[model samples]
Target: MAPGIIEMLIVGFAVGLTGALAPGPTLVAAINSTLKSGWKAGPLVTLGHAIAEIFMIVFILTGLYVFLGEYSLFVVIVGGIALIVFGALTTLDAKNASVDLSKSPDNAGNPVVAGIVTSASNPYFWIWWFTVGSALLLTAVSGGVIVFLAFIIGHWAADLGWFTLVSTGVHRGRFLLKQREYRILLTACGFFLIGFGIYFLISGMNL
Candidate 1:
């Protein structure tokens, strides 16, 4: 591959890995879907997440990229409120976290839908993609469809790898379900998510 292509791929993978591993609705959805269905559901959920990211990136790159500069204050305020609410909810959920494997025959489709909805509905995602993702794509390549597509593939691959590992581990070690320490860990993750949300909100306001 050309040097530009190689660089874009690396950037794609890095962004993908970091974003995929970040604590958020998509991650929670992955965990829930894995437990609800099975390993097979993991990839489908990941695909949905990737699809949402791709859509967001494209939307921002197009003329639809409405610069929120005029509404920065409003956006910041809204984002802050969302973060606080989301964070509190996440912390509460973690406190009472438990897997309910009860599944219906028609529930197979739920994981995919859940993944899509969670990813699409996340306000954080909209902020990140519009601000960061669009910038990356604009700088991805001066010209080359192959290179752009490769970037997308690399990004998606990272998400797929992460979801696969997370679900596989959770499925294999159901013992985490029985351990109080694990519950604490989940709670910590929740707290951290809230912290992250608050940070984002404040950062938005200052911007």
Candidate 2:
């Protein structure tokens, strides 16, 4: 069955949260900025990330989908495959993932700029847009613009919420997230991604 608008929103948030929790350049930049600045760095950084993604959204929505036309359904298949691969990798890496918030990199620069540069420069970001993001977006658009907007809202919420928590915890020296907890969360998200990938593949083939 095709997922409804609410489902899309929920799925978007879940997937976005998984992405946010992963160790990446953007997250590192946010941590460095938070250690140097304050809790505000997380949201500010996410804002810049959102800014960079706006162009990606425009490109995928206006060009990629339109160009793909009838073959767009295959995007779902590709996205499912990518998700499975990403999930397996995430799960395997979770056992060893360690975040060091104390080691602030001097070159973090402005939190916003770091977010933009790190996100835009990462090759995986584009790959994600071409696969997972595009597939999820196409699924959302199938339900109409309102549904698509819901998905965006959910995704942004996760990004903002996760980063804010990380920054706040770091700035306050709370050190709330330990390695064990982080690994568990990653493992859960990895399994969730795999499950979602299966569902997406089934939906795509049937749709």
For each candidate, what TM-score against the reference?
0.61, 0.95
How much lDDT does each candidate structure score? 0.63, 0.86
RMSD (CA, Å), candidate 1 to true, equals 7.5
**What TM-score would candidate 1 get against the native?**
0.61
Model 2, position 53: C-alpha lDDT score: 85
Per-residue lDDT of 1-207 in model 2, one digit per residue for the tens? 545888988988988888888888888888999977799999989998888888899999999789765785688889899888888888898999877776755887899998899999988789888888988887788788888988999998999998998899988987678889989998999998999999888878887
lDDT of 1 by residue, 2-43 (tens): 226776676566556656655677767777777777676668
Give me the displacement of residue 145 in model 1, in angstroms: 1.1
* CA RMSD of each candidate after superposition: 7.5, 1.3
Steric overlap count per candidate: 0, 0
lDDT of 2: 0.86
